[model samples]
Target: MRDVNPKEWLALGEDLAPKLKDFDIINPHNFPSYIWAYYVKLRLGERSSAIIWYCHEPLRILYREITDPKGFRFYSKYNNPELKTIDMKAVSQIDHIVCNSRFTANNVEKIFNRAASVCHPGINMVETQDCDRKNFRMVTRIYREKNVERIINAMVLIRETRPDIYENCSFEIVGEGADEGRLKTLVKDIGISNIKFCGFIPDKELPAFYAGAKAIVYIPLDEPFGLVPLEAMFHKTPVIASNQGGIPEKVINGVTGILIDPVVIEVLTDAMQRIYDNPQLANELGTAGRTRVLERFTVDSFINKLEKKFFSLSGVK
Candidate 1:
C-alpha cells in the first residue's frame, strides 16, 4: 500500500495511474481515494478494470443539512465548493457504488443523482463468559457529530432525578478523538464522578469491556452506519442507541435493544435507568441482539454479498 498524503493525492494519482491498470478492480474506500481513482480512470481511458466506490457516506460536508445541520457549520461554511463539484464528477465516472447502509445509499443518490447498492458490513461474533455487569459503555470517537455530550447531559439528569439508579451505575467512555479534551472538561466542570474516560482500547481487548458492561450507549446524531452497537451486541451486551439514521435498521426498539430520541435528556435518562433497574430485561435484549447479529450481520453473509458484487463487476462468474 502506498502511503501518499491526502493533500498530494491528485498529483500522485497522475504518477500512479498507469500502475493501477494491472488490478482487475479499483476499489476506493473514502473520498480522497475516490479522487485518486477518478484520476486513474481519467488517465487510463477505456480501461478494462472497473472502479467501485465503497461509500461510507457521501461527502458529509455536502450534506450537512441532512447529517448535522445544527453542528459542524464551521466545516460546511469554510469548505471549498470545488470539492463538491469534483466529488460529483468522480462519482459519475465510477462503475458501481456500494453503501454500508440504506440511509447512506439514499444520501448518495440525493447528492449524485446516482443509485447505489446497499451492503451492510459484518463483524466477527465474539463469545464471552458471563460476568457481573458493571458500567454502561460507549466505544466511539468523541467527535462533535457523535453526540457524546448528550449522554453526559443525560447522566447528569439521572444523577439529579434518579439518584438510586445513578448511585449504582457508572459510565465508561472507551475511545478518544478531537473532542476528548472538551468532553473531559465538560465532565469535570459538571462534577460528575461516575463517568470514566478509559482512553483508546485495542480491538482485541474491546470484548472484555463489552462483557463487563450492563449496556452500550451509542447515541450519535445521524450516524450513517455504526459498528459499535453491533460489536457490543456480539459480546451479548445490550445496546441503547438513537432512533435516527441507520441505527434503527440494526437495533429493533424493545427487541434487540432500546432506541430513543437521544436529543431529549429525559428520554435518554429513562432508557439508561430502565436498562439498569431490570437485569432480566437487559439479558433478554443482549440475547436477542446476539441472535440478530448471527442471523443477519455475520462475516460469512457480508462476504457472500460482496463476493457476488465483485464477480458481477469483474465478469468473473
Candidate 2:
C-alpha cells in the first residue's frame, strides 16, 4: 500500500464513485476522498452536504517539510504545486469543514479563509486489569517528530542528577518506525538498563500496555491531534506531554498531566521525579485525565457535535 502513488489512490476513488448513490453526505477523509467526493457530487448531481474531514492536506505537508527540516524529511517529488491548487479548489467548494484540533483548524482558516468547527476524534475507554503500573510508557511511531531521543536523553539526565528516582523508574518505547534501529543503539550506548524497545503492539493488546503504565510520556513535536494522549487518559494513566501543538488542548499542566518544553531535559527529568516521588499527585492527575476524556473526547460526543454541524450547514433542522 505504501508503494502506491497518491494519484493512483485518487484515480481508484474516482473510478468507484459512480457505484455509490443516494448518500445524505459526501464526506471525505484523506486527499483521494476529497477528489472522489467532488467528482461523485458532480456525477450524481447530488445535493448532499459535502463536509470535509480536513485531516491531512498535502500543502500542509509541504509547509512542514519547508519549515521543519530537522523534524521530518519528505520526498521532493511528492511536493506538487498543481495538486495544491486543486486541493484549494476542492476545499473552497465544500459546504463545511471539521478539524480534529485547533492546530488543524488554524491551518484550514489560514489557507481556505473559512472558519472550521473543531470536533476531536474519539477514543474508547479500555477496561484495565489488575496490574502493577511501574514504568513510564510511550506508545508512538518511532520517528524524529516523536522525540524518542529527547525522552532517552532526559532519562540519562535523571540517572546523572537524580539517581534515586532513576534507579527505581523504567521507560518503555512501543510502536515501530524508521528511527527504531538508531534509538535502540542510543539506549545501548548510554548503558540505560531500564529503557526497552517493545515493537508494535496490536490494537487489541494496547489496553494492557496503557492500563499498566505508571505514566505515559508522549512529547511528540507539533503533533496535529494525537490519540495516544486521549487513549492514555481513558485508561486512567497520567501523561507528561510537550506544551506544543494539540497536546496542550488534551493535557492541563499540573492538573491532568505535566507539560514541558521538549528541548529542556532538566524540566522533563523533574516532571518524571515529581510523579515518581508523589503518588498523590499521580492519582490526582490520572483521575482528572479520565474524567476529562469521558466528558469531552467520547465517540458519542463527537457524533453528536458532527450531526449538529452537518444539520446546521444543510439547514435540515
Candidate 3:
C-alpha cells in the first residue's frame, strides 16, 4: 500500500472520488481517511451505498486537552479549531459509526453527538503452555499518555519498601517512544537494575514474551481498546492494568486480572506484589483471562460482527 501524506488528503480525495463509487462500502479509519471518505461520499451522490467509519477514538487530542491537559500538552498545538470543525462535519455525513470498545463508543457519542456500535477487535489465541512465568512485563509505547513512568515509580517503591519481593521480581518494558530517554534516565538516576527496556519485539516473538510473563502491566491513560492485554491474555497471562478507559472492558479486576488507578504508585506496587506472592491466584487469573479471550475475543468473532455490521448498512442479506 502507498503512503498518502496528510497534506495531500484533499488532492487524493478529488482524484479518487470518481473511482470509489464502484465500491459498495467506503470504510475509513483516522481523520485524513475520514476526510477522503467524506469527499468521496459527497461526490458519489446517490451512487454511495454506505460510508462506515471505524473510529478508534474521536479526535483524542481534542478530548485529551480537556480531560488530561498535562499528558496531552505536547499535542495541544495541533488541536486546531478549524480542523476539529472539519472533522465533525465529515463525521456527521457518515452513514454508520463503529468503535473498538464501549468506552470509545461513549467518547464518540460525547464528541460527535452520534450513537456508535461497539465491535471489539480480536486477537489470534495462542495455545497455552507451561512455562516459568517469572518477570512482570509491559508492552506499550513509552509515551506520557501511556503512563510508563508510573510503573517505573512503582518499581522504585517496590525496591525501597519491599526488598525481598523487589529482589526476585523483574520488569521488561517492550516498545519505544519519545518518553523512552526520560524513563531510562529516571531508572538510571534511581539506580534500579531489575527493569530492562527490550525495545520493539517482532509480532511473532510476542507470544513467547506473553507466555513467559508473570503478568502484563498496562496502565495507559484512557487507552482506546488495548490490544496488548488481549494478546497477553491469549497466552494465558494475567494483566495488571489501569481502571481507566477500555482496559476495564478486557481485564476484570480479581477475576481475569487486577485493575487499579493509573495515578497511584502504591496501588500498582501492591498489585504486583500480590501476584508474586500468590502463584495459584496468578494461575487462576491467567486461566480465566485465556477463557475470556476464547469466549469473546477470537478473530473469527470480530470478523463475523464486522461482517454483520457491513451487511446491515449495505442493505444486503
Candidate 4:
C-alpha cells in the first residue's frame, strides 16, 4: 500500500464524497476515514450524519512519546503544525464521537475539548481442553512502551528473593518485536534460564496458550485499550497488569486480577509469588475474570452498543 500523505488524504476524501452521499451514518475509524466523513458532510450536508469512532485519539500515542520525560525523541518527527490542524478539524467536524475506553474518552476531552461515548472493543471467547495451567505468560509485542522488560526484571527479582517460588514457577514471553534481542540479552545477563521467548504464536494456537497459562501480565505505557488482559480473562486466566491506562477500567483490583505499579519490581514480584503459592486464589481470580469478560467485554455486548449508537444518531426507530 502507498503511504498516504495529508494532501492525498484530502484528495481521497473528495473522491469518496459522492460514493458515501446516501449513507445515513458515515462513521470514520481513522484520520483518513475522518477526512472522508468531512468531505461527505460538505457534499451531503444534514443528509448524512458523520460520527467518528476514535480507536484512541489519532495522535495520543505521538503526544505520549513526545511528552515522555525520559525521552522526547518521537516528538521531533511529529512536530508538524499542518498535521495537528487537520486532526483538529476532523475532530471538530464530527457530529458525534465515541472511543474505545474511558482513558481514551478523557484524552479526547483534553485534546479536542469534547466528550465521547465509550464503546470498548470486544473479546471473543474460545474453548480449550484441559491442560496444566502452571506458568505465567505475557502476550504482547515486545516494545519499549509495552514495559515487557519490567516483567523480565521482576522475574529476576523473584529468583533472587524467593528461590523456592522461582523453582516451581515459569515465565514465558510470547510475540516478537525490535526489543526481542535486547530482552533476550537482558535475560542472559541476569542468568535466568527459565524465561522462554516463544516469538509470534498464531491466533488459533493462542487459545491453548491462554488456557494452559496460570496468569497473564500486561502493562503497557498509556495503553489506549488493552485486549490481552481481556483475552486472557476470556480463557479463564487471571491477569496482573499496570495500574495505569485502560487496564484499571477492566481488571478490577483483588477481583478479576491484581493491578500493580508497573515500575515497582517488589510489588510485581509479590504478586507473582502470591499467585504461584496459592493455586486456589489464582483459580478464584481466573474464574472472576472469566465472569467479567462474559458480562462486559464479549463481542455481542460491544456490537449491541455500536448498533444502539448508530440508530440513536441517525434517528432510526
Candidate 5:
C-alpha cells in the first residue's frame, strides 16, 4: 500500500484483512502469494499488514479443541474454538483466507462454504536439501492420526526381510509429539535403528536438515492437507505420502513420488523398497515434482490469483 497511487488509497476503507503465508509453501508448481504487492491492495493497509496464517496442520486439528483463546505466533491472540469449527466459514468471515495447498483449499471451503481463496504458500527455495532418495525419511507432527508407528514398523519389516533395497535405507522421524515416548518404545520393542528420532529442528535450520535427507514422508491417515511433502519437493526431494485424504491432490503418485496406503506397514514398506531399488525412478519423480513446483507453486503466483479474486469481488482491479 505504500506505493499505492494516492488515487487508489482514496478507494478503500480501513479494515483488518487476512493474508495467509506459509514457511514452506513455495514449489514452482504452487507459488502462493503470487508476488505480494497485490496483498497490500486487499488488506487496505498503509502497507499490507494483514493477518497471515502461519498454516498449521497437525495443530490446526488439535488447537480448535482448546476452549481458551490463544495467541497466533505470527499475529496475536485469536479465539480458541473447537477444531471442527475452524472450517472455511470461520476464517472467511474475517475478510480473506490464504492456504498452503489446494488440498487445504478443499477443506477450508468446507468450513467457510464461500471463503478462503487459496494461494498455495511460498517457500524460499534458494537452497534445497542436499539429500538424495536412495531411501526414505518420514516427516510430520507424529500425532495419533499422523500414524507415526506405521512408518517405523514398515521400516523394520523391510530391513529384516527385504534387503534388496531396505538393507541400505532407513527412515528419519522429524518433529516431536505426545507419541514420542511410545514411538521410542515401539522402535525398541521392534529393535530398529534404521529409523532415527530427530525431534524438531529450528525453522531456519530445518532446510539443512532436509538437505541431508533423501525424501520427506508423511502419513496422516485422514489429513486436511500436509505441506511437508511439498516442502520436501521444494528441495527437489521426492515424497512417499499416504493415499488418504487430500494428499493425492498434492503429490501426484508415480510422478512426484510414490503414494501408498499408509494404513498398512506392508504397503509403506513396499513403496520404500521401490524408491530404494529404483534410483532412476526416484530421480525421475523428484525432477517432475521440482518442475511442477516451479511452474505452479511460487509465492508470486499466489498473490496474483488472490489479487484477481479480490479485484473481482471488490470491483477494484
Candidate 6:
C-alpha cells in the first residue's frame, strides 16, 4: 500500500477503520510492510490485534544462494532468516498465524515464537469436456526449485530404457520460468523429441490436457502445497510427483500416483517405469486421487478454514 500511493487509501482507511472493526493485519513474508502493520495493530488493538508473517523459503534459499546473500542476511530481522531472530514487539502484536504445513509449522516455531495453523492454498476446479485419454502426458512448471532438469533427464532415460513406452508417452512442460532455455537444451541433448513446451496456458484450457493425460508429474524441490496436482486430480488425472514438501497431503503415494525423490535419476526413472508398465494401475490410482480431492481439498473447505481463522485472529464474533 505504501509503494502504491498511500494518500488514495488514507481516506478509505479513515472512513472504514472505525465502522469495520475486525481483520487482523497479516504480512506474510513480513517485509517492511510488517513494520507499518505492527504500528497499525498497536493503535487498533484497544480490543484485539494481530500481525502474522508467513516466511517463504525463496527468501532464505534461492534468493540468498543465487542472488543476494548480504541483502538476505539484513532482511533476517523478519524473514525467519535465522533461529531466535524475530522481534519481541512483533510477536506481542499477533494473536494467531497461518502455516504452510506441519513440517513448516515446526520450523516457524523454531524461528518465530508463534503457533502457525497449516492453511494449504486452494484453486477453483472447472469441469471440462473429456480429453482423448490415450496420450499419457506430464505437466510441470520449468523452474530451478521444482527440479525440472530431473524430469527432463528421467524422460530421456524412460525413452532409452523403454523405447515402446517412450514412443507412446508425451511430456508437456507448462508455465515458463528461468529453466526454459536450459530445459529445451536438455531435451535436445538427451535426444527426446516427444516433449512440448506449452508456455502459459490459462487454467481453463488445462481441462483438455488433464482429461487426455494418463497422469501429471509435478517434480519439485519443496512445495508448501502444490495445487497443480490437486487440480489434476479434479480432472480425474492421477499425479506422479516428488515426495517432498506438503505433497503427501495431496498425493496419497500408491493410491494417487507414485511419489519419489525426483532428484535421484534412478528413483524417478523407476517410478515412471512402474506407471508405463501398468495402464490399469495408473487408471485406478487416478480415480482414487480424484475422489480424495473432492473430499479433502476443495475451494469450499479452504474458504471455511480461512473464515474461522480470520474470526479467531480478529476477535470479531
174-241 per-residue lDDT for model 4 (tens digits): 99988899999998998888799999989999999998898898877767788999999888888988
lDDT of 3 by residue, 120-198 (tens): 9999766656678999999999888888988888988998898987888799999999999999999999898999999
- Alpha-carbon local distance difference test for all models: 0.84, 0.77, 0.85, 0.79, 0.59, 0.65
Stretches > 4 Å off in candidate 3: 1-7, 65-74
Where does candidate 5 stray beyond 4 Å? 1-117, 128-135, 164-166
Model 6: worst 10 consecutive residues (lDDT sum): 66-75
lDDT at residue 174 of model 6 (Cα atoms): 74
Q: Write the per-residue lDDT of candidate 2 for residues 132-186, one digit (tens) a residue.
A: 8888899999877788898889888888988877787789889999889998998
TM value for model 5: 0.67
TM-score of each model, paired residue for residue: 0.92, 0.89, 0.93, 0.92, 0.67, 0.79
Q: How accurate is candidate 3 locally (lDDT)?
A: 0.85
Counted clashes in each candidate structure: 0, 0, 0, 0, 39, 1
> Superposing every Cα of model 2 onto the true structure, what RMSD results?
2.8
Residue 110, model 5: Cα distance from true site in angstroms: 4.7
Which candidate tops TM-score? 3
Model 3, clash count?
0
Clashing pairs in 1: none
Residue 75, candidate 3: alpha-carbon lDDT: 51
Q: Which ten residues in a row have the lowest lDDT in candidate 2?
A: 66-75
What does candidate 1's lDDT look like per residue over 1-317, in tens digits? 13434457677677878789888888899868888998888788887368888999877766676656667323535455666677778889898899999999988888788989988999887676777788888999888778889878988988889887778878889888898999999999999999999998888888888889999999988888999888888878999998988898899999999999978888888888889889899999999999899888888999999889888866855
Root-mean-square deviation of candidate 3? 2.6
